[model samples]
Target: MAEHKIYTMSVAKVYPHYVTKAEKKGRTKAEVDEIIRWLTGYSQEGLEAQLEEQKDFETFFAEAPRLNPSRSLIKGVICGVRVEDIEEPIMQEIRYLDKLIDELAKGKAMEKILRK
Candidate 1:
């Protein structure tokens, strides 16, 4: 059987796209920053450094100071796959971010989106 490799996507590439999606729905860069920091435990400075470095998603998540425990509570379908049902831990974490972005774009309150 031929082995297949998963192509890792770049967080730096998608980060601005996410911000644009959120801003179009009346969100702000600050709010997107808040979400990223809340989930990844990165300070504003650290987050900015990562963005400036243009890191890949794997590296970005790998370097996160800490992943929020409450992130597991995030439940929903993204791209036809349920976030909670994702088998790969890393992929699940990525989907959690996607779900949060979806909520932010849909105008869910920041408090709720942050799972506070």
Candidate 2:
């Protein structure tokens, strides 16, 4: 019987910002490629070491920052999430909605509540 060895591959994805930023700074395509290679290699090595040390699958697959300038912002949801960038009124509105939901769930309020 022959023993088999399995190895997991690590993939590093670079954001579009790297290329755009490099071009805007007047770096040639070849230079940009080299930079990308160096960054990806360093990131991969660091991540692999972290994974080995932590031995946690979720931590190993953590999201890395995108290199592109025009990339969309990352977003996530949580049960009691608060965002600092939004206006106070918006936050208050969310709080009110949450309260309304709780009230309805507990059979406390059946009337429609309108927010101005």
Best by TM-score: 1
Provide the TM-score for each candidate, comma-separated: 0.92, 0.22
* Candidate 2 stretches greater than 4 Å from native: 1-87, 112-116
Tens digits of per-residue lDDT, candidate 1, 70-112, equal: 9988999998999999887677778889899989999999999
Flag regions of model 1 displaced more than 4 Å: 1-7
User: What lDDT is obtained when candidate 1 is compared to the true structure?
Assistant: 0.87
Residue 112 CA error for candidate 2 (Å)? Answer: 7.6
Give the 10-residue window scoring lowest on summed lDDT in candidate 2: 3-12
TM-score result, candidate 2: 0.22
Per-residue CA lDDT of model 2 for 38-111, tens digit only, reads 32232645644553564232222333222322111212222465322333432332333334333333333233
lDDT of model 1 at position 22: 96
